[model samples]
Target: MSTDGRSAAGERAHDATGIAVEEGIRSLLLLMPRVVGRAKKMHIPEELQSFSLAPRHLSLLANLVFEGPMTVNDLAARLEVAPTTVSLMVGDLSRQGVLERRTDAADRRRTIVGIAAAHEKSVNDWLGGSARAWRAVLGPLTPEQRRLFVDTFHAYERELG
Candidate 1:
C-alpha cells in the first residue's frame, strides 16, 4: 500500500497507461481556469456590449440561433431550466430588443421566441467564435468519439452538481 492508502499495484496499472487519475486531475485543474478565461474573453459585438449579458443568456441564445424559433416551453426543455425562468429571460431580452416574441399561428395562446432581426447578426457573431472553435476541435473526431467527449463533460458537470 502507498502512503496515500492506494494500492501500489493499482497505481502501477495507471502509470503503465501514462495517465494516472491524479495526473489527469492536476492537468484539468490547471486547464479549466484557462479555458474559462479564454471563453470569457471572446469578443461581444459592440451592439450587445450595453446589454450586459450573462452566461445563462448564452445557452438560451445559442438554442434560438441554431435551432430557429421555438416556444418558451421548448426552450425550457432544451435549457433544462424551468419554464418560468425561460419566460423571465425571454421577457428581459424582448424588452431589450434582443429577442422577438410572436403569437404562434398554430396555437393562438402560445408564443414563439426568436432573436430579433435587428440583433440576429450580432447574436450570431457573438456565438460563432465558440461554435467555430468547437467545430474545429470536434470535427476530426469520429461521431462516437465526439459523443464520448460530450458525455464525459456532462458527467463532470453532474459531479459538480
Candidate 2:
C-alpha cells in the first residue's frame, strides 16, 4: 500500500504513466505562450486592421472559406462555441465589413454568413504570414515529435467532446 492509499502495484503503474503525460503537457504548455506572443507581434496590414480580426477569428473565417456559407447555428456547432458567441462574432465581423450576412433564401428566418470579397486579398496576406510563423515555430521539432504533438492535441479535443 502507498501513502496515498492506492495498492502498491496500481500506484506504480499510474505514477509512471502520469509522469510522462504531465511532462509532455508541461512542454506543450510552455510552448504556447511564446507562440502566441510571436503570432500577436507578427504584422498584419493596416487595411486588414478594420476587419478587427484576430487569430481566434480565423477558425470561423476558414470554415466559411472552405465550406461556403453557413448559418450561425451551424457555425457555432462547428466552432464548438455557444450560438450567442457565434452571433456576437458574426455581428462584430459584419460591422467591420469583414463578413456578409444575409437571410438564407431557402429559409427566410435563417441567416447565413459568408466572407466579404473586398477582404480576400487581405485575408490571403494575413494567412500567409500566419502560416509561415507556425511553420517556424514547429521547425525545431522532429517530424515524429511534431506529428505526435498534433495527434495528442487532437485526441485531447476528441476526448473533451
Candidate 3:
C-alpha cells in the first residue's frame, strides 16, 4: 500500500499524461451510463416507433442520413463491418420501407442504398437530437483535439473487444 492510498498495482496506474488511469476509468464509469441512458431515452419518431430499431441499426442509419446514398460496400467500410452484415441490415430496413435500394447508374452491378423518401424526415427527426448534441460538444474543439477524442474512443472500443 502507498501513502497515496492506492495498492501497488493501482500506484502503477498513472498514464503518460500524468493523470491516473484509475481516475480516467472512474470518470468514464460514472459518466458513460448516464450518457447511454439519456440517449436511450431519446424519443423515436412516431413513424419509426413501429420498426423496433436497435442500437446496431443507428450507425447504419446515421451514415445514410448524414452522408447520403452509398453502396453496401461503402456503408460496410464506414461501419467497419462485413458487407454481408450490412446487406442483411439494409435488406431488413428495405423490407420495413425505411430504406431504399436502387442500382447504381455508374455500375449496374452495384446497388446504392438510401433512406426511403417517405421515412427520411422521420429518420432525421429520430437522429437529430444525437447529431445536435455531438455537434454542440465537438464544435468548439480544435480539429486535432476532435481527432484525438475520436481516436481515443476507437482505442477504448478496441480494448473492450
**Who wins the TM-score comparison?**
1
lDDT of 1 by residue, 35-139 (tens): 999988888999999887988898999999888999999999999999999999999999999999999999999999999999999999889778889989999
- lDDT tens readout by residue for model 2, 30-80: 997897797778677688776667665888886776577899999999998
RMSD of each: 2.7, 6.5, 3.7
Model 2 stretches astray by more than 4 angstroms: 1-30, 54-56, 128-151, 154-161
Task: Rank candidates by TM-score, best first.
Answer: 1, 3, 2
Cα lDDT, all candidates = 0.90, 0.78, 0.90
The TM-score obtained by model 3 is 0.86
- All candidates in order of lDDT, best leading: 1, 3, 2
Whose lDDT is higher: candidate 2's or candidate 3's? 3
Estimate the lDDT of model 1. Answer: 0.90
For all candidates, what are the clash counts? 0, 0, 0
Model 1 ranges with Cα > 4 A deviation:
1-9, 12-18
Question: Which stretch of 10 consecutive residues in model 1 shows the poorest summed lDDT?
Answer: 8-17
